[model samples]
Target: MSAPFRDEEFESAWRELDEPQLEGGWQLFTEAMGVTIYRRYDEETGLYEYKVLGVLTSCAPARCADVYMDLEYRKGWDKYAKELYEKDFSGRSAIYWEVKYPFPLSNRDYVYVRERRDLEVDGRKIWVILARSSPETPWDEKKGVVRVTDYRQSVAMESNGACGTKVSMNYFDNPGGLIPSWLVNWAAQTGVPAFLTDMQKACDAYGDYQLRK
Candidate 1:
């Protein structure tokens, strides 16, 4: 049988996070139950990207954000973005927060980065695609899990400057497991929003702060 999971190790990762990341900008840390995404954004992309560093716990319950930028400032997101909201968002639990915003992307600029996907609860699938003017690397290319699931979907978005924003959407559902069905179901439905909202606030604050100064 598998050994019981421990949270102590995960907690240590947060403590080890560099405090220098929080200088000059704002830092917000919120928790639901089992997940916590630390974020930092500053005047420099290096520091803004570095602030929200690493995936602490790699499981179905994790998500992270990096940086990327839009190349054309004049080009709007009207074509790329259709609608932004959460379908399965749970209002009763308050675990999921829906974030909707139309952020303009600067013309010919790559000022933001994206995070690697980490988490696999069941046959769930994780994916990341960067909207760049030029071809680079696929953001979702990582280890752990593959094969996108049938009944799963979630999208996350953020803008860090005048142009360019990154949106990451993942869909998955963990069914038929040893763990309590309710617990698994709850997390499967709620994890995406909880993680995405934290990222939104961090990026928004950091972006605005950087622009002001």
Candidate 2:
């Protein structure tokens, strides 16, 4: 479980990735309406899952964004169909969004990224961090369907300085169609954008309060 120690090929490819590559990846993601990323390896269950996250940053100030997807794992993908996702928070609720999952396996290949723009909110710039993750999944060439079974959560954040973060995510399921094509598109256009806008509003209000307090 956990992708066979990330294999030699994967290790080599990952090693080749530098900070520039990471920044490029961030830039590409920000520019796209959304994208589908496929991988094969679930270390915990020995199954593969497909994961997708979408974005509509062009409508940032509008706060109209969406993100969502499903996880299918062969080991027990069917068993996880009815499972639910959640967000966890505690302490200093006004300053940051703290989240976690009850099940440990839900933690893997988590992608965290965010973008910032100068806004009129109290005449300052605040950064937002949108986060997402899916249990790693290995593709099944024979069946042509990736399987996954895991829970995931997303959060949003904003910073007073250059280092703070904002995060959030949108997720859904479509079992019959091989892959949830429509859901992916909807998430890119609807879920992520809306939630991100909410995060910004929250940030502006909270940031002002924090500054005053």
Candidate 3:
């Protein structure tokens, strides 16, 4: 059985991911693809987590939301996706993602459950999409691949005046083993921009791709 969704626990995540405070230790990391990125060090995990916010220019919220829901298209823009398939009812899924590492660094793989829900935030509607690795799925020992165990991620997007969408997310995955903190930091530093860039591209191409179908 899936873990019960505790109201308070989710509420906490909602606040952190949706109503972020860009104050204090949250430092600006990068800005690109119309996205602004921020990060803060977490002493508990010894990892720097990321907070990203952006608006996809001229893109509707439904389009942004649907692009995320449509898994196949994800394979095209997401360079890391190896396979994406549903494992159960609802939006629960298993995504096999391959992380591209520089020469001599072992690539990584993550098998996680990505779930989504539409809910109200501050009287406005938004989509709360969450993902994390499931313990039920045992780690496959693949050659030259490191398994990511500690992972938690969420994307929260709300419509902007019916014309565009405001997107925000928090992503962190602890790739177990001897991976250096600097490398992890570098990934977080660069990954956010690429993700938002592709998302915007996907939003732009989605319409044309459908018209031809």
- Give the whole-model CA lDDT for all candidates, comma-separated: 0.28, 0.29, 0.73
Consecutive 10-residue window with the lowest summed lDDT within model 3: 1-10
Kindly list the per-residue Cα lDDT of model 3 for residues 1-213, writing each as its tens digit. Answer: 346445554455556545786776898888766777888888887777788888876677767888988877887778877655555535454665667776677787777776677778778777777778765664465887887777888777777665788888877877767777676666666666777777888999998877876
Model 2: residues >4 Å from true position, as ranges? 1-27, 30-148, 153-180, 202-213
> Number of clashes in every candidate structure?
26, 39, 0
Output the lDDT of residue 102, model 2. 23
* TM values, all candidates: 0.23, 0.26, 0.81
lDDT of 2: 0.29
lDDT of 1 by residue, 71-118 (tens): 121022223222221112122110111112223311111111222233
Off by over 4 Å in 1: 1-168, 173-177, 207-213
Cα lDDT for residue 128, candidate 3: 70
Question: Could you tell me the lDDT of residue 14 within candidate 1?
Answer: 27
Index of the highest-TM-score prediction = 3
The alpha-carbon lDDT assigned to residue 95 of candidate 1 equals: 11
lDDT of 2 at 202: 47
* Model 3 alpha-carbon drift over 4 Å, by segment: 1-4, 8-18, 22-25, 88-93, 121-123, 180-182, 211-213
